[model samples]
Target chain A: IDAVCTAHGLSVAEFHALRARATEAKTRAYCPYSNFRVGAALLARAGEGEGESGGRYVLGANVENASYPVTTCAERVALGTAVVEGLHSGNGRGFRAIAVSTDAEGPASPCGMCRQFIREFCELSMPILMFDKNDTFIVMTLGELLPLSFGPDNMGVKDPAKP
Target chain B: IDAVCTAHGLSVAEFHALRARATEAKTRAYCPYSNFRVGAALLARAGEGEGESGGRYVLGANVENASYPVTTCAERVALGTAVVEGLHSGNGRGFRAIAVSTDAEGPASPCGMCRQFIREFCELSMPILMFDKNDTFIVMTLGELLPLSFGPDNMGVKDPAKP
Candidate 1:
């Protein structure tokens, strides 16, 4: 765990906090339709001049609609809220890491759509932590999860919000 | 137009309002990635005591993320907002009609994901109106857009929010 923390530039305490917060966020899920609850926690990259421990956490739980496709996943809900709050690629403020929690026996990663969503604002090397019901976890980078992903540059259109 | 209004049980004024609202909503789109703006309007079903003309309109515009797949389509946005506002199947207040507007030469329909999303809260016979750049239009039923779709009942889990 120490080696993993060092490699990802995350302290052991931060890692534990992410897992705990993600698990707690799961209780807030509004998934009456699927009975599948998911929670996500994001570690925002600290602004310049802020020390290594400056990163703040943002959390979200899945909000499902009767229309299955309208269901916003936990990761997306977190990202969307963050974006609305001025933490997004367009604003040049991006996330450092993300953690997701689910009740499955094994660690469950974000879905295909969520992987695509994360691709937009996170660096390729950003760590993604997946926690299972027993608190066991698996970690991977955003690039590895969604290889050959599409992003802002692929469109060849300048972000209107950017200079 | 009169033929369509009669066939769909919508008054001519309602149809016109949908077109105007959807077109106006397109101006609020935040799509910097694809540069393909889209807007949507929903006509909600009135309550039991409310008259046919009591239906209210809801609007939404596409919001794109740097990651292409994270982008929420206009139709899904309208539906999500409607659900959040308590106009959903679980509350017995579903929508009666939906309209979409885009700048394409011909009318543009909702994407596959949005189609699936719509299937969840709308009846099979619900009408979906599509408007082109010139305001020329085409209309189809939700059933025609997404045939043999999977929905809340497919999982055989009774909606916990429903009786």
Candidate 2:
């Protein structure tokens, strides 16, 4: 755990917070159809002038609609909320890490759609932590999860928020 | 236009409103990435005890992110907003019709993902209206857009909002 934190520039405390908060966020899920609750926690990257440890956290739970495709996943909900709050990618205001929690017996990673969504704001090296019901976790980088992913740059779209 | 309205059970005024509102909603799009704005309007189905004319309209525009996959389509945005406003499927609170507007030269259909999402709350027979920049339009039923779809019932999940 210590080695993992050092490699990702996250302190032991932050890692613990990600797990606790993600688990807590699961209870707020609005999934009555699948009953598969999912929660996500995003740690912001410290902005300029702020110290390395100054990042904050944002949390979200899955919001499901009767129309299955209308559902917003936990990761997306968190990212969307963060974007609305002005913590967008580029301009040195991006995300550092993301943690997800689910009740499955094994650690569950973000879905294909979510992986693509995360690629929009996070760097390829960003760490993704997935926790199972028993709190067991596995970590992977965003680039590994969604290899050869398409993004804004692929379409020649500049980050509108970047100076 | 009158023939289209008669076939769809929409009043002429409603049809005009759909075109105007969808076009207006396109201006509210947050799509900095695509720079391709899209908007949607949904007309609700009158609930039980309410007359056929009691249905209301909801509007949404595409919300994009630095991550292309994280962007919410205009159709899903409108549906999600409607679901949060207490309009859902299987409880007599379903939708009557949907209209989409894009600045493309020709009328554009909803993407495959949006089609799947619409299938969740709308009846297969529900009409989807697509309008191009010139106001020329085409209409197709949800079933025609997404044939042989998978839904809550296919997974044995009853509508939680159903009485």
Candidate 3:
């Protein structure tokens, strides 16, 4: 807990709040296919964790479909909302950090696609906190989840060039 | 157009129907945030594209949220559904191909993250068809997009243990 808190430049209480929010969000997920409930929360630069009103947003459990190829994981749902909101707000800075939790026996890791997208905004060292129902938690950096991953930059996309 | 038909083992007319369905699914897209609606259709097996109902399924657009940290791209939405349906049907085989279309200007490609997940279910040579307005199109295999990717084989995970 202390390590996760320090890594995000957050207080222990703030980090706990983030995890709690993720747990709550998991309940609202629409995952009828996998029955794998996941929840996530993001701390925007100007988000609630920063003591701001609208900067931080929370997203909860979403589902994947039987179409196999059509499923969306919980982590990407949270990140995409942040990106869309950031674009709409006219300040394209995406989420500064994210937290995810699942009801699985062990911590559910973010999918590979999400790991790549997370790198698009947060640096490799950006903190991603994950927790399981057992109260077991692991905090990792996006870079660690995907070593040498590709992002928008690799496609010649820069922040200023994004739509 | 010809390449897409050939890749999916479909006739030109059949591929057009899938693309049309993909185009129509865009209408139901929940991209209230981005307003850049997208949709997808999958040709499940070799015989499906030819209208034999060869296990093909259709999926549409769903967006992600910043607070959620998991975004369900239209393509992923369609493909994930295919995965579950395959298992439930006891086919045990994954989707053979997927096609995606979006309202964004020019041809928009799947993000790196989606590519990784797509590779998880299909072989390296699995075809992904992308199309844009004006009949502009591009074709590529999973290998072309992900190049060298990591999958269950890399993690010592056997097919029986895969979800």
- Per-residue lDDT, model 2, residue A143, is 88
- Cα lDDT tens digits for candidate 2, A1-163: 7888988888899999999989987876768778899988998877777786658787877767556666888887677556544566544778878999999999999998888877776788889999999999999999889888777777777643334
Question: Can you give the DockQ of every candidate in the order shown?
Answer: 0.19, 0.17, 0.12
What are the per-residue Cα lDDT tens digits for candidate 1 across B110-132? 99888877776678888999999
Identify the CAPRI category of the predicted complex in candidate 2. Answer: incorrect
lDDT of 3 by residue, A17-116 (tens): 7888889988988877666688988776663243455456557456677776577767778777766666323444445567888876566667667766
* Interface root-mean-square deviation (Å) of every model: 4.4, 4.5, 6.5
Candidate that scores best on DockQ: 1
If the candidates were sorted by their lDDT against the true structure, best first, what order would they fall in?
A: 2, 1, 3
- For all predicted structures, in order, the TM-scores are 0.60, 0.60, 0.51
Per-residue alpha-carbon lDDT of candidate 2 for residues B64-131, written as tens digits (9 for 90 to 100): 86555568888876775565445665347778789999999999999988887777667787889999
What is candidate 3's DockQ? 0.12
Global fold similarity of model 2 (TM-score): 0.60
Task: Write candidate 3's Cα lDDT for B5-39 as tens digits.
Answer: 77656677667777787888777787655566778
lDDT of 1 at A14: 91
lDDT of 2: 0.79
Interface Cα RMSD for candidate 1?
Answer: 4.4
Please say which candidate is ahead in lDDT: 2 or 3.
Answer: 2
Q: Deviation in angstroms for B4 in model 1?
A: 1.8
